[model samples]
Target chain A: MKDFPYTESKDTRSGFGAGLHELGKTNPNVVALCADLIGSLKMDAFVKDFPERFFQVGIAEANMMGLAAGLTIGGKIPFTGTFANFSTGRVYDQIRQSIAYSGKNVKICASHAGLTLGEDGATHQILEDIGLMKMLPHMCVINPCDYNQTKAATLAIADYEGPVYLRFGRPVVPNFTPADQQFEIGKGVLLNEGADVSIFATGHLVWKAILAGKLLADKGINAEIINIHTIKPLDARMILESARKTRCVVTAEEHQMNGGLGDSIAQLLAREEPLPLEMVAVNDSFGESGTPDQLMEKYGLNETAIVAAVEKVMARKTK
Target chain B: MAQSTASETHAPEATKSVAELQQIATQVRRDIVRMVHAVNSGHPGGSLGCTELLVSLYFKVMQHTPEPFDMNGIGQDLFFLSNGHISPVFYSVLARSGYFPVSELATFRKLNSRLQGHPATHEHLPGIRIASGSLGQGLSVATGAAQAKKLNGDQSTVFVLMGDGELEEGQIWEAALYAPHHKVDNLMAFVDRNGQQIDGPTDKIGGLGDLRAKFEAFGWRVLETDGNQFETLLATIKEGQGLLGQGVPVMVLMDTQMGFGVDFMMGSHKWHGVAPNDEQLATALKQLEVEKASDY
Candidate 1:
């Protein structure tokens, strides 16, 4: 198994702020809008550096979505900042008609995603954003794993046209990905080359999958681990090729099993290759107030859960 | 037939007489009734109600281009249909003013046509800047476009037309607070105070009491216009345009009957989205005939 080390831990929202600040310096057409959550979203660097290009839209997510759509009309690439719940569900119609249907170039950068947005309860933590954004016709859904990857994805999406949903979390997780990695949308990164089972993970669960790979290696099971950052235009070729080698697959995410990374991978596998697959994700349940680590353990989204899922799927594989 | 040159780009010509605008509005009303009757599915009541306002803006007021339709619309005045159910009027004025072929009005709401049930930019429709069928979103969009104009140092205006019942949406109130606070003075917004919606009278559905006072409370420069009268509306728009660049956005409370042109369909909620049959179409056409202007 390939060892991935982290220097320190940092929130992915800070990565977005750093990337936005970089874009503010490089791209003149890049403008930022926030719905009264600059501090929480860690957008202070962009706001302070490019005060003229930033807009404080004040507590109206629907209006922010609309304004973002309209800004595209004048050839301005707008990045809207807010929480995951307010970004997707609170203004779905605004996004549907104004941004998605119109095919505007707006980056909906959502922070505090999934159960890791601890202690704020179910109202603030959003797990269904990936499903909601991916369902839109012209939307590109991306959930980067670590701080370095999130910053790289943020910079990469500025050059990409059309609507994008960049989802990141609030908690300070392991910053394991390379600092200068070229974040490619819809391209999966191979972390380990193994043949026993394939482990597909995204967002915060990616680091856990890396840890799970080591655990499986000790048990004489060589696990193939892949990080799927972009969810919508999934790296299907990479996933299928890995699945063909391993023959059994385990998908992990910090979201519901109903409409998340697991569901998307399962559909791809069912259509292309019939393989035994197990998902390590939160079952049909809402998240409540808890620490990020406690929530990951209780909801079965940690490395142990992924190891268990791999074992369960490997047992069901055809001999 | 002198072959109407009215559709040609009139480089900021704000001098067109009210009679000329009224003549175009009558022809536009005829197009609205005919287009809706052809589809048998559209909102004709609000379309007919807003006909004069659209005609005044397109033919007499807005400084825009029709030959080469630019999506950016940087140095040109832009318009957005907030309450996009009134697409019949929007489509009629756009086609009649030569954004596309005038004959394309026949393809309204048809399959594989650019004219969807709502105004959408996805089809690359010439005049539409953004898609709007869902209400309470246009004002915010227009405000953003206005901000873009300011960023580019382009001294052009952004206009948006909305329905009275659309105000019941919470986003409208959010935008109501946004424009004034942001000093989005280059945007001119109009509310079609037509007193009726699809469910019934707006008073019975959800009363929007005292719009002038409501807009004033939101720190906007409010003006009222008789939307059915071309002369009064042109004057009101001229006055409203004067209030631009004064650190406050402008709002026009346009008083209009639900079905303004056709006597039978007038002043009621029943015709809000209902199309006219053959006999009703003939009645509406007879009332909205223009001697000089030709129908598409």
Candidate 2:
């Protein structure tokens, strides 16, 4: 089991806000456009520091997306902020023809993603965004784990060109990852090495996977924990190598099991190195108004779900 | 290939001449009919209807350099075609104005052609900056670009065109509210107010009750003109340009007849999306006389 040492806690969205402010100082061409969620998105610092570059677009996501697409023509990198639901579903067509089809370099930054967006219910929680964004050609899909990692990932994407969708959540989670770690786009970070089972997780579920690994340690089980941040360009080689040594796998994320990280890992293994796998994700059901911890437990996205999934897959291992 | 050499050799000594510009408009109309006839596909009615406005903007009003194409369009007037189904007219003017080889128009809608069903930047087309075929999104893009220009302290202006039926889209209103509230004074939007749409007239399908009053109430300075008549279009464009940087965005309601020059296709909504047959193509071509440039 991996020892994740940390004391502080923070939401991943604040990491994005901090990274955006840092970007304003590093690059003069970096500009931001928010659809009336300035305070919710934590974009107040950037707006206060660089008043000229920050654009308050009111409550119009469609127009904000089109404007972001057009801003790229003038050599500006535009980061548009809004909730995941309005960021993807409400403005899918505008993003499709204007940004994706046109091949514009726009950064679509989404916050309050998945069921972790407590109290908003299913109307605002977008579990289908990863699928909708990954299906588009030339889109780079990412879901960072915690505050420091999300901030690192945001700065990294600004240097990397092309259309990118950076998804982050609302509630505060343990900031276990290293604060100064450099984020690699398509590379997965190996948190712990083991020979019994492999655990792949993303977003807020990474900490849960670590806790599950510790619980498995007490039961005479050795587990490998890995963070699969980038979703679209799946790191198949790393996943296959991990499966070859561990012989079984467990995938976790706060999204629908149909098109989330579990589905991506399943597709990779079914083609390359077939292995027994169990998934810890929301089943086919909408969410209701509940606290963050209550929703995670109800939707089958927690440390117990990860521990149970690992045990289930371990039973299927031939070795 | 045929159009470029023929037009270049016989082009007017000065591109700034209004008489020469009117002559090119005649050839543009001929090209639109021929391109739509070749594929047995395209929107001929709206293309013919918007010819005068296209000519007035590209040849007379806009200040742009022809050869050295720049993506940012800094210090140059920028134009966007929001309703991109009317590609025949847009592509013809882009080519005739020397953005690309005029022969490229022959590849419209064919396999592996740069000119797709609509304008796209993915094909590496020079003149088109953003992709559009879906309605109601272009005005917002234009508004954003105009804001960028002002932020950079550049004096260039931005123009966008849309259809009457396109007003049914919710994004247009969202943009209408933002542009005026933000004081995006460098933007001008023109509606091709030729009442016909695919289902029927806009009033019957979903009425955009009083667009002039709607834009005016939304804090836009309004201007009206006959889009089909070249003289009225020139004056109307000048009037809109004169209203720039006045703490308000401008909107011009251009009244046009669908399939204006062709006798058979005019005065109805039947020709909105249908292409011309061989007989209809020949008839439409006969109505448009070849200019001295002989671009087609």
Candidate 3:
């Protein structure tokens, strides 16, 4: 397995805050609106630096979405910050009518995605956001793995002129990706190349996939690892290429099994290159209050799950 | 597809006399009836009720270059229809004001038409800046646009219209609290206090008590006017414009009849979304007379 060592660990939300603060200096048209989660979203620096561009919308997600859509009318790139639940489900219709259907240039920046929002329980942990956002026609869904990757993605989407949904986690994860790497929207990152089972992961699960890759290598199984950052516009060519070489697949994400990255990749393989596929996702269950590691282990979203999924799929591989 | 680039022949706003506006309102009313009748599906009651307000804004009150319809509308007054069910009137006003060819009104609600049943920006409809069929969203958008105008240092006002029943939506109150709290001064929101909804009167369905008092409590400057009358409504719009940049958003409580022109359709909630039938169209058109009506 290829090494992806990290000197430090950082929460992805801080990366977003840092990127937004940097954009404040570079892009004059970049404006931000937070639904009373300024501190939670780590937007204090941007708010402090560019007081004029920051809007404290006060615990109203629907109004924040509408205002973001409207701000695009005056040529302002609006980034709305809130939890994933409120960002997608609570304001789905508002986003549908104003931002998606109208094709407004609004960035829906969601933090505390999936069960990683530990101690908050299922109410705060949103595992359905990726599905909801990807279903929108004009929306681009991104779920970066680490701090540097999330920060680079945050900077990259500002140049893209359409509605985008950038989701990141609450807990700190190993910051292994390149600090100066340029983010490509729909391109998959190949972490390790192998010939046995292909493991595709996103968000916080990328590190887990790398761990699974190492574990699989120890067991004499050469697993291919890839990071899919963009969910809506899935890197279909890369996924199909990896699947063709490996002849089996194991998809992992800190999201629901029904409509997450696994579902998108499954659909792609089902239509084009049919192969043995296993998914490591929340099996249609809500998470309870627990620590981040406890929730990840209990909900079957860890390196063990990925390694086990790899084993299960290899057993079903066409002989 | 040989269509006119409408801005070339557009007359300057504020140059049209009140008498000229009234004439255009008559034509707009005719167009609303015809467009809805052609589809056999649309909302005409509120459309007829809102003819004068839309005509007044497009013809005399708003400072806009109605041609080459750009999305930003920078340095120009922008208007959004929050009560998008009344799109028959919005489309008629937009087309007649030269945002697009008035003949395109034939495509209203038809297969692959720019004019959806509600106003949408996806079809590249020139005048519409945002989609608003789903209620209680336009005010927040207008406030945001108003903030954008402030950020760009563009001294133009952002106007939005919503139905009285739409106040039942929690988002409107959120916006109501937001606009004034942020000191968004360059925004104007008008509520169609026609006291009607799809089922029955707004008061009977879901009451919005004393909108003026509510807006005032939310720190907005309140003004009331008759929406159907050109003289009173235009004067009220001018006064609302005067209230801009005073560190408070303005709300105009517009009192209008659900159906104003046609004798059979006016003063009731039955015609809220029903189209004029063949016999009803003949009867309604006869009631609304114009010497030189430009019907699409």
Which of the numbered candidates is closest to the native, going by highest DockQ? 3
Write the residue-wise lDDT of candidate 3 on B253-288 in tens digits.
999998888888887899898898898888888878
How accurate locally is residue B53 in candidate 3, as Cα lDDT from 0 to 100?
90
DockQ of each: 0.77, 0.67, 0.83
Q: What residue pairs clash in candidate 1, if any at all?
A: none
Candidate 3 lDDT by residue in tens digits, A264-300: 9999999999999999999899888999999999999
Model 1 DockQ (Cα-based) = 0.77
- In model 3, the Cα lDDT at residue A182 comes to 96
**What is the per-residue lDDT of model 1 for residues B1-296, given as tens digits with 9 covering 90 to 100?**
00012112443445677787778888888988998999899998999899889988888778888779988888888899999999999998998888999898888999999999999988898999899998889998998888888888777788999999999999999999999999998889999999998899898888899889999999999999899998889789878878888899999999999889899989999999999999999888889878875777
Better of 1 and 2 by DockQ: 1
What TM-scores do the predictions have? 0.97, 0.96, 0.98
Runs of candidate 2 with Cα error greater than 4 angstroms are B1-15, B293-296
Report fnat in order of the candidates. Answer: 0.73, 0.67, 0.86
Clashing pairs in 3: none
Badly placed stretches (over 4 Å) of model 1 are B1-13
lDDT, residue A258, candidate 2: 87
Off by over 4 Å in 3: B1-11
